[model samples]
Target: MHDFSWGQLVNPEFYIKLGGIYLVLFIIFAETGLFAGFFLPGDSLLFLSGIYSKELIQEIVFIKSDFLNVLLLSSLVSIVGIIGNEVGYWFGKKSGPYLYNRKDTIIFKKRYLFQAKDFYDKHGGGAIILARFLPILRTFAPIIAGIVQMNKGKYFLYNIIGSIAWSFLLIFSGHYLYKIFLNNLDFDLKKHIEIIVLIMVLVTTGPVLFKLFFKKKEGEDDNSI
Candidate 1:
């Protein structure tokens, strides 16, 4: 059996070297669809996938062209992401009423569902797309959409658009940016993967943290008054 380590779980390079493109796709699917997968490294994985697109793609299909490899990798990841969201939506739709009526468990809370509903009410369909860029929100957005019975046609459209945009932008940026730095600036992204991952995490999670902090403070202020 393969030994488990938190270090390996968080390291995108470990994933690439171990399972190559297939593992990357699975992580994207799980992170975007499964409630328990919120903590998985989606953004950094995609970025690193771009950086190592040639190697990852070659593992599955030998391709001499870097552009073709990245393109194929991005397209596959996008499709899997869309499928994952659909699965989350289906789960939420099927279990929506049950979730509302069910008592909160140690792991599940009714208030979270309520908060998702309220967020959807305020943001409408746009939340699906916007949530794609945010970490935890992306995982729950589709599920919430189902619980609230969002328009099926509208949700499907946004699902496709958001998945494609998110996958293509991050993966391509990683691949091309690495090339740019290496050729022009003499900086190698591979040598600085840790810093890159840290920046990606902060950049993606910063807004979520900011809102949570201020929201808590506002609640405290109101309680004091």
Candidate 2:
């Protein structure tokens, strides 16, 4: 059995080295649901899977799966990702009161919870959907929703849409773009897989960082005013 540690979760390569479809699925689930998993390489892992999906299928089953198969399987794992989020929500619902009552510590602050609740209030249902594409927030937003008792119906509706969008977009982008490069450029993707994953990480998170900077700037302007 492979020993799992927090250090290993930062690299998708660790799970890839472990070599099983289920291990990848577990990483996705854990990352989406557990606070400790917030550091896991979600974007890079999805990108890597897209790059390796066909090869992975062949290794496990001795036959290659086409693009459609990769797409379908990616969607299925996305559903599991939704379930993981719900688990996190349930945990927050059950533990939220006690957590709120606990004395504030450096790592665990009540003010942070209040800020999350305020953010959720300002954004409404769409925050859940948007948070899917943003790391850290993706794990905590759902929990904060539960802590604040967000409407179950609205939460589920947005959660489904977000999970499907997040999963399919990243996975298919990786898979198809690799195929395109192979066909058009005579590129050996494996030789530059690490660079490709790094680029994907930036592309995925760039928008979030951009928005955060503007939001911070706006806050400063408002304060100055």
Best by TM-score: 1
Evaluated at residue 179, the lDDT of candidate 2 is 88
Candidate 1 TM-score to native: 0.89
lDDT of 1 by residue, 1-225 (tens): 277687877778888888888889998999867888898888999999999999888888998888999999999999999999998998889889988899999999989887877777777568888888888888988888999777778788889999999999999999999999999999999999899889998999998899999999999999999
On the 0 to 100 scale, the lDDT of residue 123 in model 1 is 71
lDDT value, residue 206 of candidate 2: 86
How well does candidate 1 score on lDDT at residue 26?
Answer: 91
What is the RMSD of candidate 2? 3.5
lDDT of 1: 0.89
Worst 10 residues of 1 by lDDT: 116-125
- Candidate 2's C-alpha runs over 4 A off are 1-10, 58-65, 100-115, 217-225
The residue ranges of model 1 lying beyond 4 angstroms of the native Cα positions read 1-4, 103-115
lDDT of 2 by residue, 41-111 (tens): 77777777877786656555654448666876587669978987888788778888987898999899888
